[model samples]
Target: INGARLIMVATPANAHGDIAEQLAPFLKDDQIIMLNPGRTLGTHYFYNLLEKNGLKANVIVAEADTLIYTCRLVKNGLCRVFSLKKELHVAAHNPDDTQMVCELLSEFYDVIVPAESVLETGLSNLGVIFHPVPVILNIARIEEQSTFSHYKQGISPTVATFLEKIDNERIAIANALGVKVDTAVKWLNRIYRTEGDTLYEALQNNVAYTEVLAPTTIHTRYIYEDIQTGLVPLSILSKELGIENSAMDCVIRLASMLYNYDFYLNGRNEGIIDFQKIINSRKVAISR
Candidate 1:
């Protein structure tokens, strides 16, 4: 890691903090640390962690809105890649470093593209709209150990409609914070090149989702990881910006009940992230 110029963190969102603490001691100045699919506000959380862990290196921390590949583990030591995204949006913690980070990353992946800022990448997290709700809706089948495609079978027309409502609330929060982010429907088309008038249609049209299977148990990352790292921060931001977030709130509350855990208390909030700093940074980036 010390010898590497570019360090990519591809772990689940929940593990980011631990990874940050472990890497802080060894991180070198001018090195780049990128979170693959930062979920939401991931780089912010990680950067803060690094600082708290006594990191003195002037490293550039960046995050991607999504992973470059739609892949899954086939078995131990084996993985299957369904497809690679034609384009991927990445942004640095400091907006000024975004282009340099993208340019450096492009040597490894030509598909990399610079995003407006970390706010855009955070708000553009599609997994916040896609992952958790379906699992909650399909709890019965999942508990019964019934096999089904996560995107295709789990997300019915009705579930998809509800998911869109969640997406609408997310976009509303982004708008209130002065960040321009793609709606889930638009993001699907851009990433997968799947055409549809609605998010449900676009998801169904995405061939990459065909082989993705739903978790058979409740203790999956769909709920724990997405709710903790993705939806929780969105809920916090919506409150800070005075945006109505009943849809997000409902999901959070339901997830709490299902898991018998208070996600809000353990997840990112005002205490973990400075909401005003995030808002101010986005405003400054917009002015530039």
Candidate 2:
């Protein structure tokens, strides 16, 4: 790993803290560690883990809202790339450093647009918005090993309506943090270059996601990882920012009940969130 200036962390979101723990000692100052599509607040977990390890490295950490590609594995060491995103939203732990990281990343991806900060990137997470609800709504199919499309068949009109309220809560939290985030449908349009009047229609029209199917089992990362890591953090920040996220809360509670686990207490922990910074963010936002 010598002479490596950048490390791309593409592991499952739940494993980020553990991976950070192991990679902490080897990271050099000025090196950059990027969480390729940190579900929600992944940079915080990475930055805090490194800091707590006393690495004192001047490394830059960044994250994206979603993966740059719609991809799936064909087999061991082989993968299928379905569609390359037209746009990808990104940000760093330190927002000021985002542009530099974006410049470096543009060489690989089609586009890397700077987000306001890691906070914005985290809140803008599309997976967190898309993954859990559909799985819960279709738990029977997921559990029974019934075959269906994740976006096409899974996200029904009812599920789409439910997700609309959840997405609204997310937008409210973003507003509370003084960050602007597009709603899920608008985000879909932005990234996929697809046009639709509604989210379900847009998702149905997006051929890139059409090939993706539902999980064979209920015990999948869509609920296990997304709720624990993604919704948990969003729930925390929403409560902290005083946004009433009942839909988000209900999802978390149901996931915890179904899985018999407390995601909030068990979710990624390296003491990363630094409540003072959040308070400062509130102050700055209010001032503006």
**TM per candidate:** 0.93, 0.91
Query: What does the lDDT read for residue 105 in candidate 2?
Result: 91
Candidate 1 regions with alpha-carbon error over 4 angstroms = 284-288
lDDT tens digits by residue: candidate 2, 164-230:
8889888888887777789999988886877897888889899878878988888888887788678
Report the C-alpha lDDT of model 1 over 1-288, residue by residue, as the tens digit.
968999999877888888999999999989999999788898889989999898999999999988888788889999898778788899998888999999998888989989987778888888888899999999999999999999999999999999999999899988887788888889778767899988789989999789888987978988888998989999888888888889899999988988899988878777778988888766776688
Please tell me which predicted candidate would have the highest TM-score against the true structure: 1
lDDT to native, each model: 0.88, 0.81
* Residue 97, candidate 2: C-alpha displacement in angstroms: 1.4
Error of 2 at 198 (Å): 3.4
